[model samples]
Target chain A: MARTDPDISPAPPATERGRRTRRKLLDAATIEFGERGFHEASIASITRRAGVALGSFYTYFGSKEAIFRDLVRDLSEGVRQAAAQSLAERELDALETERAALAAFLAFAREHKEIYRIIDESEFVDPESYRLHYEKTAERILGRLRAGAAAGQLRGDLDEAHAWAIMGMNVFLGLRYAVWSKGEEDRPEHAAQAAATILSEGIGPSDA
Target chain B: MARTDPDISPAPPATERGRRTRRKLLDAATIEFGERGFHEASIASITRRAGVALGSFYTYFGSKEAIFRDLVRDLSEGVRQAAAQSLAERELDALETERAALAAFLAFAREHKEIYRIIDESEFVDPESYRLHYEKTAERILGRLRAGAAAGQLRGDLDEAHAWAIMGMNVFLGLRYAVWSKGEEDRPEHAAQAAATILSEGIGPSDA
Candidate 1:
């Protein structure tokens, strides 16, 4: 999605080796920043963790702030790709698409438990990236809702607010069921089904 | 109710004047912490902002961390009161109650725009308080949902996941429509009504 700002970050790696090195740094950063936070994290620790040379850090990122900003966008892209992959796996109605999307998200969150910490920390480290993450996510969701409405499978009046609400629901559900999960009862699919039910029929009395 | 950790904070003021001074300090702390954040914020600055003696700060709170924790709890209390006052104004059906509470919350967020920053920052400054805030808020929502189901208003199958989903919906809606509101079209009631609609009826095709 070309989320990185050219002014702040270096151009993407043109070679396979360079790309692998950059990917390694971002993975190390996810753990470094996630464990120590922005103020405490350092390039030395990240490069060391990635097993890359210290001078190579500047090949992809300009500075600590630049890397942090890029990391936020990277994580946002990861979230987007997760949903995209899930939706592409099968043809489903609007509601099932949302269910499948959320299920994928929960699985992603569980695997990358530090994601919540990183994104939440972005509010302080890089406010613009933090804001963009949600804005872009809501835009994607609104687009889905519009398509659903066009297909006559969803209410035609759905708008930005609905998208934000659904985004919020999925984010918080992942926080509770995936990040803070206690045991087996907090299954990702179980949480996804509960959320999907809300979109499909709501919590209103069934007979009513 | 008593959200403060007694060991970290002092006893409540015994007299009205003492109470007033304590209240003033907390109000000032909100602005100080909200603007400068926890790290840059100082007891002297908070006292100066409150127009109280610096030494008197010790009477209410033990240290900077203590007051920050207390401030988080105070804001949490404010949120609770906002919902309680709205719910008390008039008897509402279960769905209407959710609408009113969200409307009140939106109004509160608009007035205290810095609230989102403060609460979100609490994740790093005082993890326990941040955790408590969401946990307690979700508990309150679940309580209301249980009451609704008991009264035969909502679906009997509603559970903790439903409460978390609704809480997430309200929080993100407030973040978008209230704290980051642009102008006239993003009215609090309008957003509240949209969310209430989700709870009242699923966004499925109406005829279905």
Candidate 2:
């Protein structure tokens, strides 16, 4: 189900300026919650970070919890767009699509290192958003799998479990190579290729 | 970084009776930390739950944070034991070993549904424990992959990324199918089979 729960949902800002301010607040909130966590973070700090007026905070978000929920959704959307942008750059088969999407995700995660902390904290701060984030991501992956199956690329029997497994793999790979990366040696492309190999050919020996 | 960091490490009990008391406190700590989390969880509550005297807490753990760290390590050991127990039951090839390990993990997660929350919360409460848990688990998985490769059952090129990917797949599958499971229909064996399929044969079409 879509996250139409109005109680936690922030109303969309109308004007172009309003949207930019909202985006700035979200970016600031990401850092706030990512570092300070839900309990330690405050609306005042987020507004200060965004350089927006304290009174203007309520114009968009109802409260701290509301913005945190919205932030998770925003991050989710960013993940979706990253994959979409990567897939649009060139034509590729289903396996390559997964590889490219993961590559994009790794690159995104590297830039936004706080993502894992903020998202993982949601499990406690806002359980609904936390669950929704993974559920929606898994759903998107399932959709892709189904499309691949329909195109006679992936296995016909791919199901929700398969989607979850793939999501798990991508998320963990990001955690290792992106979030906890040492340096340039932890290349996103190499990680993506490793995952692609698993999908294109299982880890079993080539002859096996 | 063997996690022998003296600050967080709990001392071993000197006698069998002392050991039992320590075990009782840890078991109670699991329920306490699992339910109330590290901050809300109190030593008195855990001691009361364990039916041990309040003074006995310090005999085992130094503080609430100490107990929480130990609890995470205990859970990590439990996971390791589950896989070890499963693998010990019979001889299997690389794919089968991975499948059986996941099956054991799913069963463990189902029985201890509080596991995901506890382990995840460790990320916020005890960052070192959280990172160590995953790192150690991934190392174990890599060990298995290496063993498989040496046995000629898996690709010789398998590395740390493959292990992390497999660990992620297992973790996410357990989250969806075990923790958030609807009912018996979400069988551990079924989820394990789905994961095993990915490792044995990629999700690509049979002929592809």
Candidate 3:
């Protein structure tokens, strides 16, 4: 939406530069924090990893905590967007819905392993950041469940608030695939199927 | 089971002393790693926290890594034992059976928060440990699922190999609730219900 002409070109805005720098710092922070945890990840390391310089790191964010808060916010939004996009692609049945959700989540985690690790390690530094992460995730899945329930696709006894917990459970499953299982395991699709099955059938006493 | 006289024991023996020392070090390590994390916790700090001399610390644990491995194994076994106990207590309906399993998991986590942290952090140290943890859990859960299937409780479409993935997912759910939820959200009961719904309903395409 910027008007650009030969003679009257808008001065390529300073805020845009800051925005780019901020994003770079966040990306670096994710990898760094993912590698060295939240507490151990120093600003110097983050800046070095970002290649943005130490002063620029401070210019863009207040502290490590600020970076983490923003990181959490970005991850929360990214997950919501991903799930929403995946949901929009089809009208799945109950089992297919979980498969779809698991596939979407596995894809998201594959792309953002650092962010997932950052969010997980954040539990050691600030409990609230961790809480907020799940709460946001819960909100998205709960929204889905509410819609599904209203549409008669889900059970009536479903706890709206616990939707994220269930989804988060699946989301965290991708972590094992990401961090633990090196290239030797089953494909993501198979894992998704497994998760879908477990979700649809109770591990203990499902009559299904 | 020892050949030593239990009826009139005086000194518990040098081997017993070493065992006691090792036990103390592991206990202290769990609390230390749980509170300060693995990287931040030092041998000196753990000994001080445990009120033991530095020399005695080395006498028990060769290094913190050894202590961490033991803790992870110990915790994993304890959790499985707890789950086994809960399964033993019930011939309940679908919902109650799932609920009982969840209750057992929550109880294990609550009592072993430190051990939980140790295993969680271990993923970063040697990625293999994470899979090792998952494999141990999966074998047990899959064994149970197979038993359930033979008993005609579980569905036929389930894969036994992916039991590790399912166990990985559920373990994270238990952990996410314990750590991410910060003891505020009580999802153990609800998790059982949601899991029951998933199993009975299937997350795949429904017949209706």
- List model 2 lDDT by residue over A1-208, tens digit each: 7545434545788899999999999999999988898889999999999999999988888778789888988998899899999999999888888888999999999889889999999899889989999999999899999999999999999999999999999999999999998787888777888899999888999997
Instruction: Give the Å shift of residue B197 in candidate 3.
Output: 3.8
Instruction: Show the colliding residue pairs in model 2.
Output: none
lDDT winner? 1
lDDT of 3 by residue, B53-157 (tens): 997765555567766766777677777788778888757653355456666886678677676667767767545666577677766666666666666776545
On DockQ, the candidate that comes out on top is: 2
Candidate 3 CAPRI grade: incorrect
How many clashes in each structure?
Answer: 0, 0, 12
TM-scores of all predicted structures: 0.96, 0.95, 0.77
Weakest ten-residue segment in model 2 chain B by summed lDDT: B2-11
Residue-level lDDT of model 3, residues A1-208, one tens digit each, is: 5343222212322788777877788788788787787767888998998888787665666677777777777777787777778978987865576578778877887888776677666666556767777766666667766667677776555564346446645754676564444676646777776665566544533443
Model 2 scores a C-alpha lDDT of 0.91
- Say which prediction, candidate 1 or candidate 3, comes out ahead on DockQ: 1
lDDT of 1 by residue, A1-208 (tens): 6565534878899999999999999999999999999999999999999999999999999889988998999999999999999899899999998899899899899999989999999988888899999999999999999999999999999999999999999999999999999898878777887799899988888889
DockQ of candidate 3 relative to the true structure: 0.23
Candidate that would win on TM-score: 1
For all the candidates, what are their Cα RMSDs to the real structure? 3.6, 3.5, 8.4
Per-residue lDDT over B1-208 for candidate 1, one digit per residue giving the tens place of the 0 to 100 score: 6665544878888999999999999999999998998899999999999999999998999889998888899999999999999899998998888889899899899888878999999999899999999999999999999999999998998888888999999999999999888798888777887798888887889889
